[model samples]
Target: LAAGARGLLVAPSWSAPDHPARYEEWVTGLPVPTVLVERLGVPGGPLDEMDRVRSDHAHGVLLAVRHLFGLGHATPLLVARADSPTAQAVRAGYARALDVMGLRAPLPVLDSSSAERHPVLFEETARGLADAVRTGRATAALMHNDEDATWMVRRLAELDVRVPGDLALVTYDDEVAALADTPLTAVAPPKRAVGRRAAELLVERLTTPGAEAEPRVHLDLLPTLRVRASCGPPTSP
Candidate 1:
């Protein structure tokens, strides 16, 4: 350090498709005490030796799936993007949840990113998703993030697919989900807790001397599920 900063809170570019091979080495070799914030370092991997804090996205997926299942929906479809680390985590969690619940998705995981940014792709995905609901292929869906969920809902409405009526919906992020026409139920990740814990970890490492410092810690905060009108009343068997 030229900046004279004693410690660092690092959040790498996890949104990228892949990380460079030597990325871990670089972080480990840093001059100051470092703690990762919602970034790399999968458990049991090399990066697990580092201090980090992140949300338990898999647990979040479980919450969504259980909620849908409790509503009498056999298996809810997944609509997600592969654009971010969070999205990828949610996607993996969804698959794992299906396995744990002994349930299979009625349809394949739909690509929410396919509808992002491009109007044509958005319309196409909407129509496909609507067809799945209309034909009894999928009765409910777990969509990642608020924006894409909102977009899909608007397009689905145009095609005569209604939320909580023809299809139950649970979006991943709670950001603006409550503002949607149907006020979607959503999974709210512990973003604030992640940051706060990360900062505390960094400070802890900074204050503790070489021999006194605690072991490298990886903290995972569980997300909360917010129920709303979008999920509607339970379905009948």
Candidate 2:
């Protein structure tokens, strides 16, 4: 209010799993129009009525699982962290996708937390994945984000596990997945679109005289999968 801003596009921090309720309370009381970007509010919660835009991570997980199945692989094992909203979404999405596809998890979801900060955790996670592949427990896997997946690949190579040949891998967040030696297949969220839509929504609310009378909008943009060398070619069936 002091700066004379007409509207606000708020993007809450995703560094932690849970967002502070006080922040939501503050945003709720703001006089100016506000729109959230890439931040999902719990249904029926305090910020439930707020306008927001986020990626449909559940659909992204489904795409990864379905692609692996198309390549003659069983349900892909999930390797993810629980540190952020996106990570949690991917974890839940994997389980839901398995239920939808009527497939059982061959192995428990592996935790790749702190792998970037801890080389030991990274090595351990990579070993677990290699063991799953070598023992015929899993033929495919979906790792969250690009950094951890790339680290896992490097460690797996050391353990004599070959990408695609031994374990067809798909990673979330296409950011650096392409730069990996094997060029990991990844899910690409529409980040720019989310920001653009949030801004547009805020602008509409600020400009439209009767915008408060209109129902709030919640947009879930679907993410696209980028196929690469990691998952190999789809099997001819």
Candidate 3:
């Protein structure tokens, strides 16, 4: 409150599962006009109420699930951080996509929290993941990020398993995915556009605080899936 700041663009995601959401408290308490990135609005509510530059993660996850299923991979195991709001949203999208596609059996949402804890993922975690795949009979897996995909591939290699040939993989974030040994099929958001839009919103709010018809823009940028070798060739020979 004492800081000499004009405005703020925050990305304080929602709470963990079964936890209370604190967006309302934070937004109400902030002194200046603010905008939240990625996600920052209630359902069916006014977009201008809280300026934002949101990413449509739900739809992006749907595209990933559909892509895997279309490529003849039936069993999809979703791996994510247990406490991330983004992960929770992805899980919901995964479930919705499967249901809409009429898939009778629901896939598992694996916990990859270990990825964030130990800067370097542990061996036991990898072993446990491999075991989970065997136990769950998963043919394909979606990682929370490209880093997890790389870690899983290395761990699988140690266990004499190979990606695509053994377990097809898809990951989020295409930033560094192409550099992976096998290259990764990833979902990439319009990162630059997102940042630009968020900044623009803050600038607009700062410039016009009392205009009755001021613009209230809430954009949900669409993300694209970058296909590569990780999920294998699109068609079988």
Candidate 4:
């Protein structure tokens, strides 16, 4: 309130805990225009009327997994933050994709809170994935974010596991981080466009106070899958 910010644009860090709640509270009690980028299930009280844009995690995950399955991956595990709605949606998409192909299984899930606390966990996850590949358990992995996928890929390489050759990897968010990696494959979210649209909606509400519009606005942006080199044809030759 003290700062001279005309409008507030809240883009919560996906890696942060309690980001959803923090975002919810941040938008509360503020008269200025506000925009938020959040997952599903974040409470949108009167603020629901506010202009917001969200990434369609479910669709993004499903598209990526479907592509991997089309390429011959059988069992795909979903990796995400523990107990996140985004994770749940991604998992649902994974299951739906598998079910569509009639190859769905009880896939493994790995959740590590905050990348900072799980430095070693990435390596462990890579080892576990390698074991799965060796034992013919899992053939591909779907990560919640590009960071997790990148870490898993590096770790797998350290373990002498060849990407796409032995195991396939996929992830959400094709930001710079994902593109910087070798053979990066990711589902890119329309972040800037989402922010711009959300901002425009908030500005409209601010300029037209008490307009006869609903109190909440829910916007869903489509995300696309970007295939890269980390994943490959199924190892059935």
- Strongest candidate by lDDT: 2
> Highest TM-score: which candidate?
2
Q: Tell me which residue pairs clash in candidate 2.
A: none
Q: Residue 76 deviation, candidate 1, in Å?
A: 0.5
Off by over 4 Å in 3: 1-3, 13-20, 41-48, 104-106, 115-125, 132-136, 208-215, 233-237
Across 59-163, the per-residue lDDT of candidate 4 in tens digits comes to 787788788878877767777765555665676676776677676564467663334567677656666778877777777777777767766666777787777
lDDT of 4 at 204: 75
What is every candidate's alpha-carbon RMSD to the true fold? 2.1, 2.5, 3.5, 3.6
Candidate 1: stretches off by over 4 Å: 20-22, 114-116, 210-212, 233-237
- Pairs clashing within candidate 1: none
Ranking of predictions according to TM-score? 2, 1, 3, 4
lDDT of 2 by residue, 72-153 (tens): 8877899998788799889989999999999999889888855658778777788889998888888899999799889888
Candidate 1, residue 148: the lDDT equals 87
* 144-208 per-residue lDDT for model 3 (tens digits): 77777787788788886678776778887677889999998998878788989898878877786
Q: What range of 10 consecutive residues in model 4 has the weakest lDDT sum?
A: 38-47
lDDT (10s digit) by residue, model 1, range 1-237: 687998888877666445623477788788788887877654566677778898999999999999998988869999887778788889889999999999988888877764546777667678879998878888899999898898788888888988988899999979999999889999999999899998888877777677226677878899999999888644453
Clash totals, every prediction = 0, 0, 0, 5
Q: Regarding lDDT, does 2 or 4 come out ahead? A: 2
**Model 4 misplacement above 4 A:** 4-6, 12-26, 42-49, 83-103, 112-117, 177-181, 208-215
| Residue 208 Cα positional deviation in candidate 4, in Å, after optimal superposition | 4.8
